[model samples]
Target: MSEESGSLNTTAAVGEKINAISDGSQIISAGRAISALVSEYVQESYCYRWLTKEPDPDVIVIDLRETYAFGPFITLLDQLVPHIEDAWQHSRVGAAAERVFKRLVEDVFAPLSETRGYELAAAMLAPPEPPERRNATVDDSESTEDELS
Candidate 1:
């Protein structure tokens, strides 16, 4: 076996061992799911791999409240993630991701109080939607401009 493959096998074996030794054997969520969310679905407009793979819709819900993942996730939301409106319309998982994006604006980036952050937050929190609902489009097109004013 190649070094990386062998290492990953060793790691999985170690994880299995640890779980077996613990009081209750429970599978922990891995960063691979998060990575898939980032790489395949969130960042790739044409992809729905994240949604298809997460058996439970809630599996994909990112807790924006997580302080550790907050910075990196916010950076991705602010810079790289393209809002896939069609996916939002289709998948509940896609719709649920809105909370993370909204919190990115209202809580973290909004504190910075930059013009861009304010604009993004306004766009995110637009139309006085209730806490359960948020606008899913992050398109910077004129349609968004119309909604802003």
Candidate 2:
């Protein structure tokens, strides 16, 4: 098979089934198929440590059970975004999947940083803070002594 065909097969072979709760919400229940795909295609990816939350469209939660596939294939997301948007626009579940896709790309699939944790911390703190201003006036001018004087 051509490389393109192979990739298509790899993606198609992977599968997931999401269960929607009665409150019109969904969560992943089984992920072995997805895990197998990650093991096959995602180098250096590891099992998700916890359940991760998507920051938008608060209708669903991603079960980290299947996100380990992001370790290497995240670069594809730029291309995948169009597909994700198309899929999501068609279904709420797909919308949730798009968020999951983004999280995986951000947390695992992106290249490892050479900078140390301290470097990141320093960068965050590097921004200059606004200088503190002195408060000029107080309302304590009502002393009886001033009146007597």
Candidate 3:
């Protein structure tokens, strides 16, 4: 099959798996498939090479936004959010899937400045900080201030 046809087939397969996910194991499996597809795309795309060579954060950000492959990649990743959340509630596989997903995103954007890379990856994959944790941190800081006073 032509490369484009092969890629489409792979994407379709992954999409089907994503839609069919009913448990944490399936979520992890789908995530792995996505990582593989993204890895292949990065290895073959000019954007990766350009990202490696480019030094300017502004330029990197612009190119990332403008690249033809980026839009579809982002969309694919976006589709995983709800599934990941559902998986998190029931099994340990959510953590595994999260690690794989985060690593995949970080690797793709690693060529950019650390801050920029993190910003982009966090934007794409970082789950919101749990409200309880946020509140605990705030309470701790307030207590510390009271003690100091």
lDDT, candidate 1, at 47: 56
lDDT for each residue of candidate 1 in 1-149, tens digit (9 for 90 to 100)? 59999999999999989867663523334455567777865656645556555577555766674668687777677664455555566787866787778988898777777778677987897877554443344344557798889
Report the lDDT tens digits of candidate 3 across residue range 1-149: 69999999999999888766644576678988999999999988998887777577765336554569797787777799888878786777867887888997788656554686677977889799999999999999999999999
lDDT-wise, the better of 2 and 3 is: 3
Candidate 3 overall Cα lDDT vs. reference? 0.81
TM-score of each: 0.19, 0.18, 0.24
Each model's lDDT? 0.69, 0.60, 0.81
As for lDDT, the candidate ahead, 1 or 3, is: 3
* lDDT digits (tens) for residues 41-103 of candidate 2: 555434332233344676686754447776345557657989978876899897798899998
Ranking by lDDT: 3, 1, 2
- Model 2: residues >4 Å from true position, as ranges? 1-100, 106-126, 133-149
TM-score top scorer: 3
- Single out the weakest 10-residue window by summed lDDT for candidate 3: 58-67
Would you give me the overall lDDT of model 2? 0.60
Candidate 2, run of 10 with poorest lDDT: 131-140
Native-to-model Cα distance after best TM-score fit, residue 79 in candidate 2, in Å: 28
